[model samples]
Target: MTNSSGTITDKTGAPVTIADDPDNHRYTVTVDGVRAGHAAYADRTDDHGVAQRVFYHTEVDEAFGGRGLATILVKEALDDARAQGRKIVGVCPLVAAFLKKHPEYSEATSPVTKQILDWLKR
Candidate 1:
């Protein structure tokens, strides 16, 4: 079931919520009101000067492992990006793996480039 705040109860009955915290440059997921994980990203201008969101890391708290929170987090993050008209780039392993299995996002996804990696280093 879903709550008015947009939180949903998963199969385990854990109430989960995902929201973008742009100040932190990440989208965070909370389970039962506790932060479970976040997908970190950076906003960058691509070769064509189009703004894109580069997801470079994702992690869930060890206590929350195996809850599929990462998948939930990434999906919401990607959807939000698309809603905002930002192209997606998955540099993080989890995000890349998710993208591979979810082709519906292909048109909104951008290939990871050396320039993006280099920008991340700084």
Candidate 2:
């Protein structure tokens, strides 16, 4: 979408939107109003005494695949969590992979417990 700053967006005229939906326990990613991807998580406590969320799944719609939407979606989700003084546990394989590629966030990630990991499978 074109804002006051005159930045252009996708064909639908809506700029990319990313936000944490705490009620649903997932971060939603949208492209011009259409849901493009999401990063799912479960909330818990981290070692640093900060709130932690275990990212257990991340996915992009098949139509949105090959466009790096998942990467963008996950990055926004992770970045937002970090910005809020929260830590993340990368149980989601995609997120784990993302962390490896971006070590700058590695230190902010905490380990996931087996119980939490098992819960994610359900």
Candidate 3:
């Protein structure tokens, strides 16, 4: 069963919750009601005018490290992007690695491009 806020139990059995903070352009993950990590992203339009969500970075608190929180955070962020009809661009190494291991998300994944990188610099 899932919690109303979409909480799930992590490997350590702690209640984990992931939510999008659009105002900050990131998805935050919480463990037992405390913030654990976040996957940062930027919304932009691609050359073809397609909406894209570029995941640029992912970080978990030192105290929350090694708990599989980053994986959960990225998965939730990617899923959210897919649901919102935005293509996923994995600029962050962690996110890129996740995409490599998860082929199911390929349909929604976009290759990182020079234009996207330039946009991110600004």
Candidate 4:
């Protein structure tokens, strides 16, 4: 998973890379060297604390969706965050929903997610 030049090639020659555009606070994920997924966020610091509000999106290409490409993108996002020691604010409904189903990923959510438990209310 080397991010050299913002690309990671799989063993079968399929490459997936993620890019962080600090100016826009967006990250694009590419598969086999092609754009397959994306995530955007707003980073802010205030009197309470600093937080990164995030959202994720994936192309509807049949070749990508059915293959769990979005999940892979989420995994990559989590892995990247782990490496960078950052907490996330899951503003994307899909990501927020995912965190609800996977408690192990709770740490990946923002500090306030417990209060945002609308998903669990049902």
Candidate 5:
């Protein structure tokens, strides 16, 4: 997988940075070098570096809504996960909804997402 580096600026000219925190194994997304979004997760492995259960929580700045910043964040988060060879467990409603709307991105999801979708089925 190709990692998108350099910078992706928001409408206000803020550079986007999606970084994974080694300690928490979560992601912190920044725009223009300032925090615009974040996602917390749990990464567990057994005798190997493989990820087990990755529960995620993501949120976007309200001011950045309607501009697809949330989608951008999700895309970056999923891209990072794919590069790291990890699956996702989206605990955030925003991410869950995004997944429901874009089945193409479901490749990043874990088995738990199906259970979550059971309740989210329309």
Candidate 6:
């Protein structure tokens, strides 16, 4: 999960911070320095030179569940990939389901293949 904190948005004046922890291969979301959620992914470049971000798991702490943190985690993770011109791959069911619900991100998602899933497991 992320360690370097940065503010992303502020709707009610309380900022939400998202940070990257590449050593852990995940992005973490924190509120007021308290960890709230995270989205984990594996990164690599495809043979075609496309940056691929394969998200495998995303979760919010039980105490923070239903506070829309999971949505924020996914959005931050996906948007980060998009900003890097990377295509997202959904190996985790949660990510796949999220994409289905929010097709706005469909254009940036990479097609899932056996190879992608196999690589994520490693």
Best by TM-score: 3
The residue ranges of model 2 lying beyond 4 angstroms of the native Cα positions read 1-14, 46-50, 118-122
Candidate 2, 1-122: lDDT as tens digits: 34577643444445777778889999987886899889998877644466887898898899876666677788878988888777878998999999989989987888767866766677
> Which stretches in model 1 have alpha-carbon errors above 4 Å?
1-7
**What are the TM-scores, per candidate, against the unseen true structure?**
0.91, 0.80, 0.93, 0.63, 0.66, 0.83
Where model 6 places Cα greater than 4 Å from the true spot, the runs are 1-14
Candidate order, lDDT descending: 3, 1, 6, 2, 5, 4
Task: Kindly list the per-residue Cα lDDT of model 6 for residues 61-83, writing each as its tens digit.
Answer: 89766566677778778888889
For model 5 the TM-score comes to 0.66
Q: For all candidates, what are the clash counts?
A: 0, 1, 0, 1, 2, 0
Decide which is better by lDDT, 1 or 3: 3
Please list the C-alpha lDDT of all candidates, in the order they appear.
0.90, 0.79, 0.91, 0.59, 0.64, 0.81
Residue 75's lDDT in candidate 2:
83
At residue 43, give the lDDT of candidate 6: 89
Report lDDT (Cα) of residue 63, candidate 4: 58
Cα lDDT for residue 5, candidate 6: 68
Q: List the residue pairs that clash in candidate 4.
A: 15-32
For candidate 3, give the lDDT.
0.91
What range of 10 consecutive residues in model 1 has the weakest lDDT sum? 1-10
For residues 5-99, write the lDDT of model 1, one tens digit per residue.
77676557788899999999999999888988899999987778777999999999999887778888998899999898999999999999999
